[model samples]
Target: MTENGVPILQLSGVSKSFGAVQALTKVDFEACAGEVMALVGDNGAGKSTLIKGIAGIYRFDEGEVLFDGQPVHIHSPRDAAQLGIEIVYQDLALADNLDVVANMFLGREVLQRPFRLDEAAMEESALKTLDSLSVTTVRSVRQAVAELSGGQRQAIAVAKAVMWNSRLVILDEPTAALGVAQTRQVLDLVRRLADKGLAVVIISHNLHDIFEVADRITVLRLGQRVNLYKTAETNQQEVVHAITAGKLEHVPGMASL
Candidate 1:
């Protein structure tokens, strides 16, 4: 547990390469249960590469991944899922024509004893999951995705990730495109995810949203982890400096890279 309790996910000296390009260089990261870790960086800062490695889309060439304080290998999305990690990409990847219930159980649908698609069970489970997340924006679980607002769709995407008992949920730019009210609703859901004792990682460029929902902030620059900070100990300026310059003057008791 490294003294701070066992982290749900931890990456140590993690590096990934694509042919001749070094996408990540000795990156160290950790996320704990019930805490929101915000990953912030500029364009081409290797944020996406880091997330891909964790998602099992791109294997890290060097380093180790520890889940619940035990070393594990993740080579595919299924492997990550089996470890109780779920990621919601920025695009959301929901089928517009499908209803909220159908989208929630798209690939992992439940079946009854007779091998028939269990519509009642799936709908009930979907509604229950949404309720657990305190997602009440959408009027009904049977509402079509195409008919729901952007915030509602984002909520459903998050709900789907959490529905499978996922311990760690990573959201990529969840509130990038939405009105003020919609953004607020999505941020509220993000906080509720942590409140339910699930580890949450958010990749976003919005400092405002990060300040609003994150408990800790991890900054990446030039394919490397610059610094990690407690949200309360650092302000927007310090975070911005870490993102642009990769370092800042050491705070009183905070770790220095």
Candidate 2:
């Protein structure tokens, strides 16, 4: 927590339900600029519900979403995007038929005139954004998305978020399918996102991947948040205990995820 008294993005007393099923229970969590908050839990941990609420894929039945210290209601994905919230799913959703440039600027295409597509400007900006993240050796902006490796796909997804000027980028299982080298590549990209001052929320199951890149860890048990811990102040065992037992008997300042 910062002495500044507010996180870049905050959810306070947030709750959600599907009829009688309470998917989330009075959850409070926050993400700050220049940091990665890992949301981890076992099966049926309410991680998905919480993420859906945050991403505006599902509206919360209760509580508040504070972006930059102001209360706001995100009614839809469009609303989230307008607020600079970008969610990068594990699938990436890139257009395989298009190249990196085309995929990055999909839907929000630039036009040279009233109706003509601005191919030149789009390619230039895509290259610029990828380059800013130190993503060189892309071969060409025209290379098809289907032709890229797993790591390159992840990089493109992240680069797309960065291109949107997203203040908070939520990543779901970014390194799940990658080999060790590819995993390292995605992790490095995540670090770069934080270093560029974007608040990142990562949903992942791999402990080593979580520990390698996350500055803070948020754990969910059942459908409730059990604990949130600073990575520097806790060990993997403590985190594991919190995930399974829903409590840490010895750790100071350990709140349930």
Candidate 3:
């Protein structure tokens, strides 16, 4: 990745809590450029909490976040976006009534002059981005998002994220609720994102999809990071064990495991 696998995004001893409930505890996580780092865990294992913290949805109660090896404070979603971090949640967030181009530039539309939209520039850029990602399933970029299949919608959401020079993209359950062929399409797009030297963190419960796309797997259990494994060096059984029974000493009712 980025010279000896130095992480573009790194978190050290990160912790977050809500009143009496600890969602994340001293969790160390990193994602390097040119690789897909899959964040996996059983339900309520802090996967969402950890990414939300990184995405600036929730501030970490403790620990430091470093980007490009320099400490930075992320206090809001806008801050995260400025830092080139984009997270596509499972909802995909595309407006069904809008066309692909309109959806891609929903908030940050290019302007031609005083109070005019740069329709040509926006369309050209959108087409270029979709083409660059090898997203060819769409019949036309001008077509309504509601007409596209699940996979095409996911692709548009991802394309919208990366169009703004995003350095790191976090996808939450991208392939979930898709058909077999659609799943394949999204997985291939995930790999292409990493191949373009962008650090990609994918959160998914499907170990099969994780193994197919991720270069490294980070497993969380009971709000604690239990293990990190290189995909080629480990198997699904080991990852499953880590998710279900990995040891955690600090979390309540989990120390015995």
Candidate 4:
């Protein structure tokens, strides 16, 4: 939470459905500045639906979205971006043919007079951003993204998200497919993002990784928010139980489990 106790992003009574199949039902979620909020759930638990809604890929059927305590409607990806919201999906969305500097400034490149690409300025800004985030594994900003390791690629994706002065960053499965050292590198960077005062929402199924970097955990079960836990106060067992068998009495049309 911020000084006034308002989360950087908040959703109240959010619901979504597809042809009578409820994906999210009156769910609420919030992410505070300078904190890592982990969204954990099993497959079909509505985690993706919630995040996509936040990113404006799917509009909520019902709910009010608040950003910095002010109401806002995000109708498209561009709308979300303009509101300082950035989403780095699991794919990383980087062009393998492009170099680090080119990927960082993709679609938002700087231009000099006569529409010339401001290569020097873009490179300088990219280097500064990466350095500020302590991403030193990248050998050269001029090297093609295809030549980087999994961890290095993930770092670049994250760096791209925050470099645009984004206030809320949502990462989907950031460490999904990586070795131990690479996972550690990505997790450390995730923590550093929160430490730098950005509202971070990380979606991952790995409890170990979530526990390592999250300040709070939001568990979704069967399209409903079943539990909220302070990472320090709850154990992995408890969280797993919540995900698999949390109370679902409030969710209509769901069978008792």
Score every model by TM-score. Answer: 0.93, 0.93, 0.96, 0.96
Question: Which should have the higher TM-score, number 2 or number 3?
Answer: 3
lDDT of 2 by residue, 124-222 (tens): 999899999998757888999999999999999899987988999999999999999989989999999988889999999898889889999999886
The pairs that clash in candidate 1 are none
Clashing residue pairs found in predicted model 2:
219-257, 225-257, 226-256, 226-257, 227-255, 227-256, 227-257
Indicate the worst ten consecutive residues by lDDT in candidate 4: 248-257
- Point out where model 2 deviates above 4 Å: 1-6, 248-257
Error of 1 at 242 (Å): 1.1
Every candidate's CA RMSD: 4.8, 4.2, 2.3, 2.4
Clashing pairs in 4: none
Q: Which 10-residue window of candidate 3 scores lowest in summed lDDT?
A: 248-257
Q: How much is 236 displaced in model 4, in angstroms?
A: 0.3
> Candidate 1, residues 1-257: lDDT per residue as tens digits?
12343489999988776666666778899989989999999987789999888989889988999999999999999999999999999999999999999999999889887678999999998888988888888998888999999999999999999999999999999999888999999999999998888999999999999999998999988778889988888999998998998752223122223
Between candidates 3 and 4, the one scoring higher on TM-score is 3
Overlapping backbone residue pairs in candidate 2 total: 7
Angstrom error of the Cα, residue 176, model 1: value is: 0.3
The CA lDDT of each predicted structure is 0.89, 0.86, 0.93, 0.93
Report the lDDT of model 2 for residue 53: 86
